[model samples]
Target: MNAPWKSGSSGGRDQFAAYLCDDAAMDVLRPIVADLGWQPEKCCRGGLRNAVQSLSVTASPNILLVDLSESGDPLSDINALAEVCEPGTIVIAIGQVNDVRLYRDLVASGIHDYLLKPLSPVQVRDALTHAQAVYSAPRSHDAAGAKPHVSTAVIGTRGGVGTSTLATSLAWLFSADYKLPTALLDLDIHFGTGALCLDLEPGRGLTDAIENPSRIDGLFIERAMIRANDNLAILSAEAPISTPLMTDGSAFLQLAEEFRQAFEMTVIDMPRNMLINFPQLAAEVNVAVIVTEMTLASARDAIRMLSWFRAHAPQTRVLVVANKVQSALAEISKGDFEASIEAGIHLSIPYDLKASSLAAKLGQTFVDANRATKAGAAIRDLARLIAETGEAQADSTAKPSLLGKIDFKAMMPRTRKKAQAGG
Candidate 1:
């Protein structure tokens, strides 16, 4: 199926920018460039002099690949790009010299990647694809001063129902798929597996973070987390069977609030028994993902939880997800499950014993096991759906009001004012 995120029917052209000055390189890369998902209008080809001149007037591109082999003066090309390339533009330089010095220099100057080319379309596509992937990985600083973060609480109806698994998977997918920073907090004080799930054994995440929640900032949180992958970061204690930790709801809120300040997405895997205080949490959350099973008791409890949110936190979006769905005939169907809970099944992750076992044994998410698995693909789709739907909802709510202008720059850097004419 085609990705729903791709906008259509607006006659909007899909474009990307590429620069190739060498005739030989252009011949080899033209087809490859086409395959990289960019149009001719999105690409600009010229010698070093012409390309540099056009840089000031050209629109910023999502991806830029320049053949530095033909351009003897790489500095000039780099300078031109640095001035006009957008904040997150991905640039790859193809060079003749395989010298480490040149590669290091370009990378240090903020070029995403460098490739030594005799030139193949596959190679160009691969390099550009990788650069786009890396460049799109969201940085922690983006949310530093932007709007408040969205905190999602992923709680399981039963203990062994894989709350930590679901939470970590969702967090990792959010960070990896949407290219947004995500933080997963294991709220289970006595027995939390968030650290184990991501194969991270940090000193003390929640324990240390809660001790002096007042000092929780981006730096502090960064030091507390264990970097799991390119996008996902885990925050929790070291050992699963560790000693008791002192953490009250106030401390939790304080840490969560800081997480909100630092990360684009924050997910708290609240303990199932802690649902007694669901109202309190629902009021503060932007969304709550409730993971349940086919069992009747679990369904009943999920229904109650849904009703609780509907009655109390009407503004919060509650998503019901069925985890470890064994078979089509085991119990309730999708329609019945939704009817029972009175909330649609936002996501249904099929049972993948091999993937789940490997992840559990190695303390990794299924998506990390192998990106091509059924579970991995489903999680990617789920993440994309969540992100797009949220964006659509936000767009719908954003309308020009009585005020002459609307500030659509929610989480972007402030624009510098034009200098006064004679001041």
Candidate 2:
């Protein structure tokens, strides 16, 4: 069982395979499998236990369908199956149970989808089609030299707090200075300045994906995103304000998934309203940058957002950044604002109206436009900290290679003996 939203198929894997407990279900799944142009023999006769045994010996398929009907405890059997299943294989389970709690539990356990027994051809076909879509969704790795994707979402506690500026600057620093492949996702669908700040024409790619969520894939990503430089690309939109938002937020999520697959770093310029309406969008983010000033309103909203994240997305690391700080002419003192939010302001960017205006006038990111300013120096420091965080995450999750584990010096004696013997 893998994350429903995340899956992949490695090399030498069949496009589709199934293990059915009975003939009736197999009959339903067979024709649909064939409709997808797959071989009928791939749909085998068995159940979850058989799947575990078979996959243990052979490579797992890209899309694995297993029957849980014969199992006494589905969850336990699924765990057993997981032990043998390869990483990133998309798994679908067919079972007789129709309980909603069971479905939620199975989803939490990482099953891609669960189908109740007595399935119809149409239902099977639909499920299989959706599974294929998930399979075809962009993946982060294809075997060698796979990289860890770090996602950061930047939000403003209040309007006119320079959230976009910080987002753009951080993205620029990551791409131009730290040299990480980066993607800047502007969630402000109608009024985004992301492309404008970088002197780019806002494209219709985001709007197209919003109109048709199913069309999102690797190819779609490659075609839709506008490259900003050798290492940076951005997907932004300028939809007409008259049009209403019709999506259930799935398009944005699908975009986030695609970003994870396509770029090493994803900086999402998420509006506060989006955070309120679409909380799930923040689920996979590695960090959240909350930009605010030392004002009572900002402090109150920061407090609320900090609590919201603790309750909703506790896994994400929160970084509170106070922007446009002027110690002499501040609404609230830095210490008082920190006390109000009950968390320290991680970084405070000093007020530099001239620097900010110059960046906007030049159509450049603040860090790129005002490197000599103290505000620029602070942003660069923030970027360094963020980069270090990424490096630490990479180090923590890195898997030791075979070569790394080999003791070459210790093996030299054996090598010398072999050389002397001329074997």
The per-model lDDT (C-alpha) reads 0.61, 0.77
Q: Pick the candidate with the highest TM-score.
A: 2
lDDT of 2 by residue, 44-97 (tens): 988988987887767778778999998998878877777666555677788886
Over 4 Å off, model 2 = 1-30, 37-62, 66-77, 84-88, 93-144, 394-423
lDDT of 1 by residue, 1-423 (tens): 111132222133223566776677777767776676566554556744554455455444565666675676686557655654444456666767655435434533555556666776655665566555544555543424355456778878776776777788878888876678788888776678787777777557667765665445557877877787776777776444555444334356446645766677887888865555323344456677788887777788898878776775565667777778876654777778778877788778777788888887877676777578876776666666656555443334333221111111111111001110111
lDDT of 1 at 290: 83
Clashing residue pairs in candidate 2 (N, C-alpha, C atoms within 3 angstroms): none
Worst ten-residue run, lDDT, model 2?
Answer: 410-419
Candidate 1 stretches with Cα past 4 Å from truth are 1-148, 238-246, 361-363, 391-423
